[model samples]
Target chain A: MSSSSSADSRRQFLRQFGLTAAATAVAGPTVALATSPSTMQYDDQKKLGFAIVGLGKFAQQQMMPAFKECKHARITALVSGSPDKARKLAREYGVEEKNIYSYDNFDSIKDNPAVDVVYIVLPPGLHAEYTIRAAKAGKHVLCEKPMANSVADCQKMIEACEKAGKKLMIAYRAQFEPFNLDAIARIKKGELGKLRQITADHGRSVKPTEEPAEAWRVQKKLAGGGSLMDIGIYSLNATRYLTGEEPVEVTAQEFSDKSDPRFKEVEDTIHFTLRFPSGVLASCTSSYSIQEVKRFRAFGDKAWLDLDPATDYYEHHMTIGDKDGKRQPKIKEGNQFAAELDHMAECVLQNKTPKTPGEEGLKDIRLVMAIYEAARTGKRVKV
Target chain B: MSSSSSADSRRQFLRQFGLTAAATAVAGPTVALATSPSTMQYDDQKKLGFAIVGLGKFAQQQMMPAFKECKHARITALVSGSPDKARKLAREYGVEEKNIYSYDNFDSIKDNPAVDVVYIVLPPGLHAEYTIRAAKAGKHVLCEKPMANSVADCQKMIEACEKAGKKLMIAYRAQFEPFNLDAIARIKKGELGKLRQITADHGRSVKPTEEPAEAWRVQKKLAGGGSLMDIGIYSLNATRYLTGEEPVEVTAQEFSDKSDPRFKEVEDTIHFTLRFPSGVLASCTSSYSIQEVKRFRAFGDKAWLDLDPATDYYEHHMTIGDKDGKRQPKIKEGNQFAAELDHMAECVLQNKTPKTPGEEGLKDIRLVMAIYEAARTGKRVKV
Candidate 1:
């Protein structure tokens, strides 16, 4: 639809919903329709086209189903290393045959106007390469987290997207989840007063009991460090987000046993402290042998925000507490993945930025690097 | 009231309340009635007389009122440098004229059987001298917090008390407070699962505002340091009590301003990390110029225990969050001071060891000394 017609339809939709539409038009035709969908010409909702780049277990089981339920976005293309799985998923999702692309033929999708955004669900090692390549192919990128395995990789991905003039948003779904967002809002609004300290931990028993001799996760070159880079990055990111300050220094300790075959390549558990500029310190831990899911807390003078099972894979809850009274009310039953998908779509259509931007991902990667350095040197590391 | 009659009355009170009287009966004759009183048993209270060694502001304000409400305890003697104020307070509290003792005549309280316990509320530098003398005098002791300024002093005080066979308990009131005790109980019960991280921060805006330096709180010899020894020691004690673990190592950073006259003799802020044997790491900070107060968080696999404004001077709140699919429930409107006082009374009357024993205080003092050493040497110090 034309920009004027789309704007008119959005206005009509807003009016029907008893909401006011912005008078001025935004940059794109999609922006106008996204802003006001009340009195437009088109009756059908315009869906932003998304493409899945990796047909891994997570994509097959979680992301694919989440996309099906998304109102603003739809899966239109598939790119995978496995041709059989790619063909099956593409057919199941009703994508056109021409929209299917292999790893080697991913660049051809640049000219296939149907795909507007590419969600990079590849392994940790390949995230930087695919993100850069996708950006060069003129597609907005939603890269899965740890952003890239290293700070340099994150910076490169961000620069590549900047050069290509495409949005590069890291998929830190926690930033978009309702409970966590509420926590962020409460913290930013000074509901917790001056944040004095933060504590975050994420762990789970991911030990391979009777699996293969060596998985990609157990490989240092592919996954970086074991728990710190894999799951501990969440603790680091969430702490920074809640405190709203970059850490000045870090002191960390790692536990790894070569005798345990699972920990042959990387550390099994890691603990670190981040000293912020505001004098707020964060104590964080991540472990792969522990059966704990997620936890986070931000404490201040007047109140505090705590999330128990904070980064739960599926559901999460957040609570705020006042100094004199009990904990503030909580927002429960939040789906991080669904919330993130919707946010990404909003960022694309509305010309906004994702909450977990490339810079944020880079900062976490830097802290992670420093933690690893500190653990190795047996000394505090400045970031 | 005779011991036998007191015991009978205690049993009657316990039976009326449907409680076990056997617990109090085992405590012995002197404690029989005090252990389980039906009302504020003023007649049977016996009035164990107390001698305030240092008539400081805290002693005059906090301890005097506490003693007034204490059924079995009374401020019968005063030892102070300010004879005029001591005489005035002694008359007001209805102490016998002969019970009023000056600093030079403090030894007289040793011979006077009227004074049973000597409360050392003196400066940190003076704690060693008075506590030793009080121990020599064979008086039970309840020294104010930081037990003594140094680890050596803490050790000496404990030894003196042990040698004299008189109880020495530090005023680490958090152990007795209901909210803190509840948090400890929840943590010990494994309600939050395996304890992973402990975070605590205690700070206040204690900066002087052009007033003449009147209080001993700003003096290094008196208060030890700005915030760490004054309020931050509570965090240290709370972490140990809540985790039930001793930290193996500590790394610290201290900030002081030679330019600011107020901080010339002490640190303005300090940040430290404690690594426990169970791999639970604690990040703690204390500041004198910060606009924040006490907080503590104990995180575990299944849930967390959070106390924001944890060290509420008047009121406190405890929140327990479980991974049961919703927000954690909170216990509110808790009075920490009254609970702490009652617990101390119970310990004395029932002959029970306090949760915050002299040993706990000594451990915290050792940790504090290690933190100071680390800050000075710019290296991690083993505790």
Candidate 2:
């Protein structure tokens, strides 16, 4: 709302839009403009030894494989209830047999020198416990997002990390992806014009499964919430990272088919709209009853940025457009998992704050809670 | 909500989805399924004549030229305040100058037997007056969408046409577009599985202008509403057409920079989310402060149909996707304006009700009012 800053922004907008003085000379002046990543080190010693927690599908399929490409991070230990699977992965990753520990013995990892950081890749309900335990065990923590089930839990995890003087980074891999990074950089340059509106939709059909292990995501106690906690968090986090603005208010509506056992404990779909202090509006949807549609699109006054399949483990296609038309800028491909993994390692080495630290994750949890509140009460909830 | 009807739907869903008995037996019986365009004939008659009631940009640029491709409608009269421009267009399009009429004498078209239908292509604020007058003139009426300024006005227009016994069609051109029709058919055939969610976003940049004629759209009285009435209607109407259901409720939010003179009289952006009776959720956005982006995408439990630039006047690209992948099905190109024009002509010739009749338009206006009310009151408004 400052006049001088807006004048600077208007001048920047004019330059980016190819507007000349002659055009502005005849036309009048307009509205006042609304006010609108990381490093690491690994110099001294061996690569940071990360203990893989909860060796689930994401761990075995994405994280462990991604560690092979990481310059400053490597999986040196494993923790899982399935000892046979853990031992196989430990051998595959060249971890000592003693380094493999089950959850019952996980706290004893404090005495082990191999684990420099504990990466918590558990269900939403277990994230806080594991993160806080790992912090108490004197290791830095890299946890998956939706940080935890509740804001209080997330705060406890952050406090545990802070009290122990250890870094707590939420592994928001999208923030580190090269394509998303390019979009963030371009928006900061005023290349996409002043951001006006944003849309984020991420969904996939989820049906009831026979296996209890496979159905934990649909369980309220395990996943914490429903589609919004799992897939919907991507849409919520994208709005924040894309605009770099916290929403002032949220209005949300949810649909849960109670007769469907898959949705009896969790929601099927959650659609929410956000109002930002800068006057940018965002409409987002996260659904468990629909096919996969990962979309993050933002429209500025002059141009727009769109990321189709905006988030996944590996690669995302991004395109930005203007009056001349759309173009997919070629960005050097980088693994999001690897980028985020290495970032945590570097942050620990340099004693620097992680870009998506516990506090950042906590902000999203606050918004998610507000969204659910709005949906439940049928009213707009302030964040 | 009926059990027998739901059984029929489940059977249809299973057959269309290629689901086998084996898959259903293991998954178990689940939630009851959520209870989830057009024609014309013109024979033994000369082509119906259309009198274009506005010589505005849309009329001059898109509609007049599309008449060349129309099979059952042709330009026979002109109505405009500017005589020179109207006469020039009339002559160019092979219309006699005697058929030219201004607003003052527009009602006298009743004596001209050549003008069989009046195509109301004027601004949104003028639709009711012209549609009613055209109906009183004993001519069938084809009014452009966003029917009228208010629900009451739209009701009056519909009643006037019904009282005069003239066919009144709202020109929902997308309904007549072949690609959109293909999407509609595929959805009805269950090719897209059970419809679950809809997303529509349409926006473009607008700047302040000196000319009154050029700036009528940004004026509240002249245009009735801002971007919502002009471009946002595409997103709103698409949700209805794509799902073939009326929204039960609407929650909307608006953002307009009052300091910007262009938005002082009207909103700069309006975002709305709707809930349909069948549990399908829709999120829509319309803006005047951003670059052009037209998108309409629907996701079913099994498949998705997307129409990029869904409501543009001419050719639009469409893609439908399932588990196999996205495919752009080739649909024979059709001119939307001409299609709607000929549709009205055919309805009049056959004495059949038009697919997008006055009642349909009135329904949309009522929803639009609800949307505005929702935005202003910061509450969910039932449609």
**Best-fitting candidate, measured by lDDT?**
2
Give the CA lDDT, 0 to 100, for residue B152 in model 1. Answer: 85
Per-residue lDDT over B311-356 for candidate 2, one digit per residue giving the tens place of the 0 to 100 score? 7776688988776768898888888788888888889989999999
DockQ of each: 0.11, 0.52
Contacts from the true interface found in each model, as a fraction, amount to 0.09, 0.72
Show where candidate 2 strays beyond 4 Å.
A1-45, A208-213, B1-45, B208-213
lDDT of 2 at B136: 84
Report, for every candidate in turn, its global Cα lDDT versus the true structure. 0.69, 0.80
What are the per-residue Cα lDDT tens digits for candidate 1 across A76-195?
888754555566777677666567765556776788788888999866767887788789789999988878778888989999989998887888877867777788888888877777
lDDT of 1 at A316: 65
Residue-level lDDT of model 1, residues B1-383, one tens digit each, is 12223233322322321232123222221211112112221343366777877665566766576665565667677765454555567766766656766544565567788787787776565676677778877887777788777888888988998898777777776775667877888889888787766668777656444432223456676566667888778788777888898888887776655575777677766777787887676767776655556888776757767787677655565666654533445555544444444555566667777666678778887888888887777678887
Docking level for model 2: medium
Model 1 / residue B118 / CA error / Å: 1.1
